[model samples]
Structures are given as structure tokens and as C-alpha cells.
Target: MEIDAIATAHAKRLSVADALLPTPPNWDAAAGTELSVRDGVALATRSRVDAGSPEALWRPLTEYRLNVRLGGADPGAAFGALLTEWDQLLEESEASDWDSAAVVTRPSRDTVGTSELLRRGFAPTRVLAVRPADRLAGGPPEVPGVRIRHAEPSELNTLVRLQLELRNYDEQFGVLTRRTDEERALTSATRELLADADSALPSLWIAELYGKPLGFVQVEVPPAAGWADSYVAAGSAGYLASMHVAEEARSSGVGSALAAHAHQLFDEAGMQAVLLHHTLANPRSTPFWYAQGYRPLWTSWYRRPAVQG
Candidate 1:
């Protein structure tokens, strides 16, 4: 069929999967490779990202990103056929030998063709979670020894260190790559995020133990997080960018306290919902976040290097 009809059909499928799912409405189908079958249709785009690019910091060193659309009653079979074409397209691309990944994101509740995804060697590596406003309705419990307070711009290095520890922790899962200049990028990224501060909105909060900082949570509310507003169907949404605690502070209630601190700010800002990403394979993260009332809204499935079988 036509690309316009494909877009409309793809959107309808996602809406049925999860009504709250923030559908990405536009991708230039004319520029992508498309395959139409008797019962369904598939469209995908192949784009590469260089390691040195700022976007690569969150993804693999280099990435052959895939934006796939499989729409029909029989998405399972259609998706299986799409993967065959996906492989052929990669083989014809120049970066087939590059150190990168072929990644696709789908609504968390979309399960029709996931068996094909796994059989084709893809794994769900990341999750974008959603916590409705009601989750923050309850007050955060008091952690006796942990003091959660707003972080200062002067404490840039301190924030970066804690954030680095998080990245290092997530590395074991293979979703986050270690960059040569990670520290520099981490510092710059952190600095830029902190600079968008609002006098009335305390976006960053640090938790201290025995007068020593141990954990932090950086949250951006509406107006503060306007960039993320489009992702949610709610009146407004907040972003939980980063939250980390030192290794020594694990299981000491510091992280819990930090989340509570963030929830309080989200409540004050009149947020309708909050969005954040977490490594799906993380042993501790999934349970901890679920306890905080966050549930998966999107899942990012990937295979390292597009050539991987």
C-alpha cells in the first residue's frame, strides 16, 4: 500500500497495543525499504551513528539503527519475513562490518511478534517506564540517617562521579558501551543538564550520609522537561534523568530516600506522570523501580552489530 496508509495502520496497531504509548508518527517511508505481502506490510529504515557523536553516548559505539513497522492481524509472520529482508539490507550496507548494533523499540505491551525478535537474536535490553501521578500521591518514608537535599552547580564533579558509577554498573549487561572519553562526555552532559535549572524548581537532589554525599536523583518537571511532553498522553510529564548511589551505600536506604525526594518534587510541580529508562536485565533495578510503582511502557530490543545472527 502507500506510506501514508502504512503510517496510519502502524499507529492504529500501537494504539491497540497500549493506548498510552507515545507513537512516533513520522518516519520518511519514501527513504526506507518496504516490503508488502498478501496479509501485511513492513517498513524499516537503516541509519548509522558514529561513536564520537553525542547521541552515541547512550547507545553502542556505532549503531545501525532500525525503525521497523509491521502492521496487520498476522504481525508474527509478517515480522518474521521482515527480519529476512532486514538481514539482506544490512549485508548490502557499507557498515556491515562495523562495531555497532541494530536496535528497534516497541510498545512494552506489544507482544505479537516478540518470539520472532528473540529467534532472530534480539534481546530486550532497555525499558522506558511510566509512573502515573497517583504513584507519587503517597509521601516518601523518612530515612533516618540519609539527608536528601538539593544539589548545587558547584558540585559538578561529585554528580559526575556518582553518574559514572551507574554507567559502570550497567556495563555488565552490554547495553551501555564504555567510551574512550566517557568522563569528558559525562561531565559535559551533566553540566548541560544542570544548567537548565529553574529557580523555583530544585531539579537535582543529593542525599548525604554522615555529612558525606552518597546519592542523587535528577528530575525535570514540565516547562523544565518540556522536551518530553510529547511522549505522554497526560497533561504534563516529568523526566528522571539520572539516579545513583555509591557502591558502599548500597542497601543502606539511600537510593530509596532519593526516589522519595524526587517524587515529592514531581508532585509539587503538578506532574501528571513521570518517565525514565532502566536496563531491563539489571538484577536490582527492575524490582526497585516496580516497588516505586513504575511499569514498562516501551521496550528497546537490540542485537549488537547488525550482522549478528
Candidate 2:
């Protein structure tokens, strides 16, 4: 139960996961090597769930995450032991106010951890994918009457409106559940992004046809220091934070044109890779991302309404 022992266990789990899908060149194993143990377990807090529901319904919610190493004698029992320990830790701490728990593992045709999670009421929710910037081919396609450009300061309101629309689209798939206040909070956050001159978090790109808005993409040059042992390569990644095309423009190649432009910018900036997350449940997302040359680096498995039985 020592931290060293837990780190070793986690390392083994990461190796197995990497082997399943192969970590991209931009990622470093050393990032995953650094770990701290609490209560005799190495735990990684993925995020706080604040999707906008009533505080009573979703407040105090978190996702407790871990990587399950499944390569020991009696692998089944070993995984079971880890799960038991995790459940016990939850029972013993106020931190367990979690509404759900999650884990990302390598995909294998057959893996004990995958089966165990499935049986224990968890489901795969999101996928994290990466593609090398150099892999982007050709130029941004030319669409009749379509123009792509970075957003000007005067267009912040339009960007916010587009984001709201994107949020609405995601809500249809049950991916976002923000309350009105939370939605307004998101708007405030986006506005701050627009106002910050020193911020490198995400740069907005707008696509217009005949001088009318059609879609937008948010891109960023990610700081290498922030991502340790993540699927992304440190210092060399340009992240596609978000992208959306209006419903009427979906089949008209606006998304592709915008993506191609984003890739071109990243390539010009000398980025080696691009990373993004998309929900697997959304039929429109999965195929579109894959077609753009992205492959899964990590898969998030979850169970919603994560209440303890």
C-alpha cells in the first residue's frame, strides 16, 4: 500500500495501455511516472463534475480515476482487489461525494479490467485522440462562398453565440447538463478568454459563407508542463479545444474547411501533434474525427448518476 508500490502498479498499467494503442511520439512516459499516494493509493482526480444541474443533483460530484494494471499472476483477483480498495477508500472519506467514477485503459480484445468495469455498471463515455500535425495533407479546401479567418475583437459576441449553440447540440446527447447559472458562467469564461491578451489557451476561428457566419473552431498551443504522461506530446501539441458547424452547413464541407485551416496554422507554428476529446455516443463526432486522421489514445469509461448502491 506504499506510494512506491502504488506507483509501480500504476506504471505497469500504463505500459499495458500504451502497448494496446501505442503512445504517440509527443508523449513521455516519465510524466506518468511521477505519482503521489493518499491513504495508500495513487489516485488521479480527473475533473470536478459541474455541468450545470442543481447543486443538490450534481454538486459535490467528482470522478475518481485510476489506471488498472492487469499483468500479474491471477490478474483477475489483482484487479478485483484494486477495485475493492477504491470502494473502501470512497466509503472512508468525505471525498467520495463523487457522483461518478471513471478510468481510462488500453483497449484490448480481451482485458480483465474492461470486463470488470462493464460488469460493475461503468460504460465508455468519451475518447481522447491524437494526430500528428504533419499528417495533415493538402490545404484547407475551397468551398464556394466560404471564407475562414481568425475572429476579430469585434466578433466576440458571435463567438459566444456559437458556443451556446454548440452547448445546445451537445445537450441533446446528454453530454452537458449545466444549469442556467452554469451556462452563464460558461459565457463569462468565454468572454474572459476573449478579453485576455496574454492568454494562449484557445484562439477562435470563424468560418463564414458570403460574409455570414457558419461555424467556428477553438485551437491552442498547449503548455508542455501542464500535461504529464497524457496522450499528448509535451511542448509540441496544438489542441483543438472545440469546433462546431451550424446544422445547415454540416454537409457543405464547412467543418472540413475549418479543420484544414486549423491544421495549417498548427503546422505553421511547428506543432507536432493535435489532441482533442469527443463523446463516443455522438454519432456525428466519432466518424468525423476519425476521418480527420485522429486515433484514440485514451477512452473514458463512466456511469452517470453515480450514486452508491
Number of the top TM-score candidate? 1
Off by over 4 Å in 2: 1-60, 74-76, 91-112, 172-175, 196-202, 224-229, 233-235
lDDT score for residue 65 of model 1: 55
Q: Candidate 2 on 42-126: residue-level lDDT in tens?
A: 3333446455533422222565565544444455555655666665555554443334444544443225456767776667777
Listed in order, each prediction's TM-score against the native is 0.89, 0.76
Give the range of the ten consecutive residues with the poorest summed lDDT in model 1: 37-46
lDDT digits (tens) for residues 182-282 of candidate 1: 88887887787668664577667889987899888988776768877666677889999878889889898998888887887888888888999999999
> Candidate 1: lDDT of 154?
88
What lDDT is obtained when candidate 2 is compared to the true structure? 0.63
TM-score of decoy 2: 0.76
Q: Residue 198 lDDT in model 2?
A: 73
Worst 10 residues of 2 by lDDT: 33-42
